[model samples]
Target: MDIDGADKQEEKPVKKAKVAAAQASASAESAAPYPDMALAQDIHRLTMIHAGKLSVDDATSITGTKPEDLLERVMLRVGAGSSKPFDDVIKENEEKYKAIEKEEGKDVSKVEAKEKEEQVDDSEEPLLNPELYRHLQSTLAYNSSSALSEDQLKTLAAHNESILAILAEGVTKAKEEAGDMEVLHATMEIARYQAKTGTKESALAAYENVLALPKLSVGKKLDGHLEMARVCSFWGDWRQMKDVLEKAQKIIASGGDWDRRNRLKAYQSLSNILVREFEPASKLLLGGIATFSCTELCEYPEYIMYAIITNLLFLKRTELKKNIIDGSEVLQVAKEIPVVLKLANTLYECDYKAYLHTIVDLQPHLVANRYLQPHSGYILRELHVLAFQQFLDSYQSVTLDSMAASFGVGTEFLDMQLSRFIAAGRLTAKIDKYGGVVETNRPDWKNARYQEMIQKGDLLLNRIQKLGRVVDL
Candidate 1:
């Protein structure tokens, strides 16, 4: 009896260890990327089992399945194999639904009579809940497809709208049935589609709705705030962007994980950019660039060039050198994103023409990046001023035509640009439009020196008079 008890005690520890391991594994998997193949397979298998879409034996035999394999099996079972598309599936379901409608129309009274007769059959249950079945099938169809084309996008958008309508028909019931996370995820997905398809207003509304949901998780709220910030960025709404970012940062500070670090850093970088806080932006970008994983770096490579550009703009070369350029990672990243090196070199050499050409070449890419897009106009203006200042340093007086030719622009354009600078009190020079020359009118150092001495004498005289009065002299 003692031997058996000892064996049971040992088994208890083993069981506890297994339970702990399983829990740890589950937590790790939950934090993994959505597209992780292994995690997808696990979710697929569990979903199939829970929905009774697979038999017990089949479920037992479904170990070590790949995502593609699961997708193929589900497609084949639904009469949608490699040759079939999502549109065909939708059309097929629509046809079946139409046929059911016709049958119900002809047999309405008969169905009512049959239902009355079978009222005593209390144990009877629906073979399939139509709503759940439809939801499942639509999800499967969506997951089984490859990248969506424009036509697919239109179809999907309509489908999502209908789903939203259905959910809206009973908001309380939908929340109870789908849970807050699922609803929030659906809303975010729809908002993203709207944003991508040029329905910015609708997207913004949907994102705001996500924030309004009660009992929403911090993670989902943060995501909604971040997405709204992106929308604000698209419109160059810096104040709204700042507000959304502040909310997102608060959520993260409350206990968001490292998995969200890259996104947080990216948003902070952008917020700094919009406010023209280049020094903090540069530091944030460099810190993220240094600490982010290879996968993260690949996912958010825009940080590299933005960092280099910000440092160059602020002339924080010493800090940039100490924190970034002097490091080996900058060189490695430069190899991955060559624009970093190009911008750095252009800034160092003060090559206005080359810099302008580089900026023009990279305009499309800059406009696409969420962090950089909102600030592109400001960045371009700063570049133009820097380029003009560099060109001005080379000559005391240059003809507008010569300057235009050097900058590869027309005289009128150059005149307009220089005029803007002059008006802004930035250039410290004037344009001699009649003479067709731009002349440097920097303050004369000797006269400025004499004026500084006179001011100092006046200040000293005032101080002496005050002191003499205090001393009763």
Candidate 2:
């Protein structure tokens, strides 16, 4: 029965599997470039036949192949393989030929030859007239090593704007070729002189021209951007100021080693824009703080501080004459505030004492409604003292451990407080000499209060030590 069934099945159907391998192999070979260089050349030749540069008959005659096959190969190489489109490639070749003719001065017609020779002689003469030369010399001499006199700069700036730009460019080029640092120094002096004498527009134009020079490096570009941003900020052109800062940030982010001072200045300019414009200040600040926390770049602290101070000042302004506080909103703001302050204090010239004083003064009022805590007040006191001590004693630099010890708490507790300082731009953290471990400092301690506190803390610590020694004896 089984044998009979098998025979019936065989008679009923015979199956065959269809493989697509042969078709795919053919398709791949068609897509690939010719393996032989001679074949590639033949293809390229055929493509050039209709390219208008070569006659189709000549192309076929040279390659000893049909115009169609030559065209196909050329299209495959230029259009689809190793060559460009036939028309474009031919046009480029034609342009090159014309350029060679132009370089050899073969394009000069008989009538124009005599005129061209005369023109060449005219071009050899210096463009600067006697009077202009005298003025240029006097200006260069006066502004050589020092800042230009206000009157002289004003006089020069009063001339055509393009003249100032040309002069600046010339100076930049000469200095660059001469490898003289003093050139930039002199240029800045001239710019300052112009700015001070009411030729700010010309001065900026001159600086802009200098910045636009190709020889200027990334560092120089940043300097120019920073200077422009500063001028714009002074003019209350916040938008342009922001734009320049953003450009500087991009340059720096792309591995440009801008001077530290310029980086900080750029950040300050951006922060000022945020504060003044009130456009996305909070988000920018928060993002900047987060970036600093992650990257630990030099400018991160500056950004974090800028955000913290701007936000705190904003909040402080709002808090005045307000009794009802939204807990969720306040907490959300508060949480980020510490983070910003912590980063700020670690790296910037933070006004820790002022920030602490502000926090302390406001804490009592805030605590009444359970907005802050007693511990928060204590942390402020400790921060103030610790920062003060650091400011007083050169060796006693403020750090999380020192701050924590002052409050009899762990580093974690101090870290929380430090976060607020970082957010506020009063403090910053860095990898210490020990490596991998963090250290902290207050960047904005320039105020007299911080100095005063430092002195007072020194006196108080001394007295306590003396009393303890007496009691032991």
Candidate that scores best on lDDT: 1
What range of 10 consecutive residues in model 1 has the weakest lDDT sum?
Answer: 3-12
**Shift of residue 466 alpha carbon in model 1, Å:** 10
TM-scores of all candidate predictions against the true structure: 0.47, 0.27
lDDT of 2: 0.39
**Residue-wise lDDT of candidate 1 within 84-183, one digit each (tens)?**
5667755653453333323332334453344335433211211111222233346544454443344644554565455445434334433455555555
Every candidate's lDDT? 0.54, 0.39
How many steric clashes does model 1 contain? 0
What ranges in model 1 sit over 4 Å off?
1-83, 88-224, 227-241, 252-262, 271-283, 292-298, 319-330, 335-340, 363-378, 391-420, 430-473
For residues 1-473, write the lDDT of model 2, one tens digit per residue: 11001111100011112122111122122111111223222322322333343455554444455565543333232221223443353345345323322322222233134333433322112121222223323422322222224453344334324333543553555465543343543354345333322223554685676566555667666656655654543333445656777777777676664233334343453544333443355445433332222111112323333444344433432341131032222233343235434423331344443444455443322222111121234434443544534433343344556545544567775556556655665545542433323454535567778898999999999999999999999
Q: How many residue pairs clash in each candidate?
A: 0, 36
